[model samples]
Target: MTTDTTALRLYFPISARASATRFWHRLSAPALAHHLINAARRSGIQQAVLHPIQSGYLKGEKLTHHHPEVTSMRHPQCVELIDSESALRKFLHDHAAELHKVRAVLLKCEIPLIPNRQAG
Candidate 1:
């Protein structure tokens, strides 16, 4: 079966150094990813996943990759949140102040629904 759902993908830098304008104003605050995850949990999202990209570039920026020798470099990160359309929309609306500074994409998609069967 196919179930309709909404997917919200947020792309940002892994390091706060690269996110000064987006989320690094406060020194005591948690990383943007963690903060967003907590917000999603509180918003009752069905699922949230954080993906660390090995090599990629954000809009109008140079390509970057994770280096074993250099840990200070900023790497790309993508946070995916899947849930009902209304729920996801509400989450975005509630966090618009913070979200407006980041690159966010929302899409309508279908997820497969599997039946849970117990062996007799």
Candidate 2:
């Protein structure tokens, strides 16, 4: 049988220390997941997986079902940070090098396939 490979937009929510460099860094896992879910909705990909890198964990959720409001990426390492566009820009400016590391890790994530319905 031919398998269909769906396009997925994978996002990793890192600790504040890690995301400090990306202008768009402080966005929460749930918030970012919502953005990606909207992208999936536009792209017509019904299913995808999310990995919370800060905690080194994986969670399966229906993209279409996640809340659409944006929020902060609150982990022990990232609390007390403002989640604004301007704030993110300032954070990126102050921590460009460290943000690159976050990007590198995010780039390496692999989306595993969902098992067959019978097995699942």
Candidate 3:
């Protein structure tokens, strides 16, 4: 039996904005999720939580992990780095504007079979 316990959805735009004035049309939630699931399956993760990314900051979750949601888009410059630590630093240098969306949703894992823990 495959032991599938952890259920955390990971979502984010593929081409995260590198600047306030740049938005890539290649970014799509469905496409990104499809690729992610395929990669996970290939790596032997039998099951995984899936949801659309809502919002986030430099490191990971926004506002001390207790704010309102989890995950976020890659800041423009960070997107440029792809997998470099330097890219992350760029995000830290510019996180204010990218993290100011009011209509962002708290991404639900696989349609929410279980209710999420309420923020305290």
Off by over 4 Å in 2: 7-9, 14-30, 49-54, 57-120
Q: Candidate 2 residues 12-88, lDDT tens each?
A: 44323332234565563334344433433454444434443333222342222122364234321111122333433
As for candidate 1, its clashing pairs are: none
Taken over the whole model, the C-alpha lDDT of each candidate is: 0.78, 0.35, 0.35
Candidate 1 TM-score, C-alpha based: 0.76
| Candidate 3 deviation (Cα RMSD) | 14.9
lDDT of 2 at 94: 52
TM-score, per-candidate, Cα-based: 0.76, 0.28, 0.26
What is the C-alpha local distance difference test score of candidate 1?
0.78
lDDT of 3 by residue, 1-120 (tens): 222233333334434332323244345333434444444455454453443323344344343221244322342111111212332333323443543421222222234456668799
lDDT per residue for candidate 1 within 1-120, as digits (tens), equals 566688999887776322234454555556788888878998889999998677897787688877867743457778899998788888888887777657889898865667757698
Question: What's the lDDT of the predicted structure labeled candidate 3?
Answer: 0.35
Q: Pick the candidate with the highest lDDT.
A: 1
Candidate 3's C-alpha runs over 4 A off are 1-4, 14-30, 52-120
